[model samples]
Target: IPHELYEAADVEGAGPFRKWLHITIPLLKPTTLYLMVIYTIAGFQIFERVYIMTAGGPINATTTIVQLIYQTGFSDFNYGRASAEALILFAIIASFSFVQFRFLSTDVEY
Candidate 1:
């Protein structure tokens, strides 16, 4: 954000909260959208941390879809179910990514 915008807002009598809400947030939309999309994809792919940390945390409290797929395929030897689960996870991640890009990809001019 430009310093001049905040100065102009100050000249216009906009208080700190109003200036932040109206100016700062709007200007940061693109960055916010990018972070949201990236974090969402990262969240869906979480596995190693849980696997190495608590290994699904007592009673599977920390079990993620990817970890479940791993257990299903490697531990239980259920390749068919694991394959289906992997496909479903892929579809879910793809849909979420598509929706995020479609809805939040506005032409933001600073």
Candidate 2:
């Protein structure tokens, strides 16, 4: 989308940076914000990378909230706390998604 906008701007004699600031960035805000949320959630739930590389070692340097829940539930045999934490995480994600959708949705103008 940004690339298309930039190409159109270029045909109109706009500079690259100007095209980005004037045409690309504004159009990309919603996409950028959505991607940011997705990437942040993915980072928060990161496990395989930590497990394969660090195993949450070095004093839990790579231990994310999801990994902590997993350790508590499976390794330490504590299901109740883990379930509570999981529900909290789900609620946070749901709320964020709802807010993002509400803010990013476009209303058709006749």
Candidate 3:
């Protein structure tokens, strides 16, 4: 799909921005939305990478919500707050997944 679009755009001398807006983006919406959800969940759970790379330092530049939960629960011994944060995260993920599934599962009748 992308290759065909790119070829057509190239033949028409379309610029990259025009090609993306007119061809690539429309064709890639489904894949992009799925990947966006996956990346958002991954970002929410970012811990080890930040720990190993930044130690959540530089005034918490790399501090993630998951890292904060771990620090609160284990380091500060605040299990209740950590649990609340976890529940919030779960609710966000569940809502996104439900919406994505509902939209993707619909038939696009031509």
Query: All models: lDDT?
Result: 0.93, 0.77, 0.80
**All candidates: TM-score:** 0.77, 0.65, 0.60
Number of the predicted model whose TM-score against the real structure is largest = 1
Q: 1-110 in candidate 3: lDDT tens per residue?
A: 64776887899999999987877666666777788778878877878988989878899987888888888899999999999999998998889878876766433221
Scanning candidate 2 in windows of ten residues, the lowest lDDT window is 101-110
| Top-lDDT candidate index | 1
lDDT, candidate 2, 1-110, per-residue tens: 63666677778999878977876666777677779679757866778877889878899987878888898899989999999989998888778877777776554221
Give per-residue lDDT, candidate 2, residue 44: 63
Clashing pairs in 3: none
Residue ranges of candidate 1 with Cα displaced over 4 Å? none
Which residue pairs clash within candidate 2? Answer: none
Alpha-carbon RMSD, each predicted model: 2.3, 4.0, 5.0
Each candidate structure's count of clashing pairs: 0, 0, 0
1 against 3, candidate with superior TM-score: 1
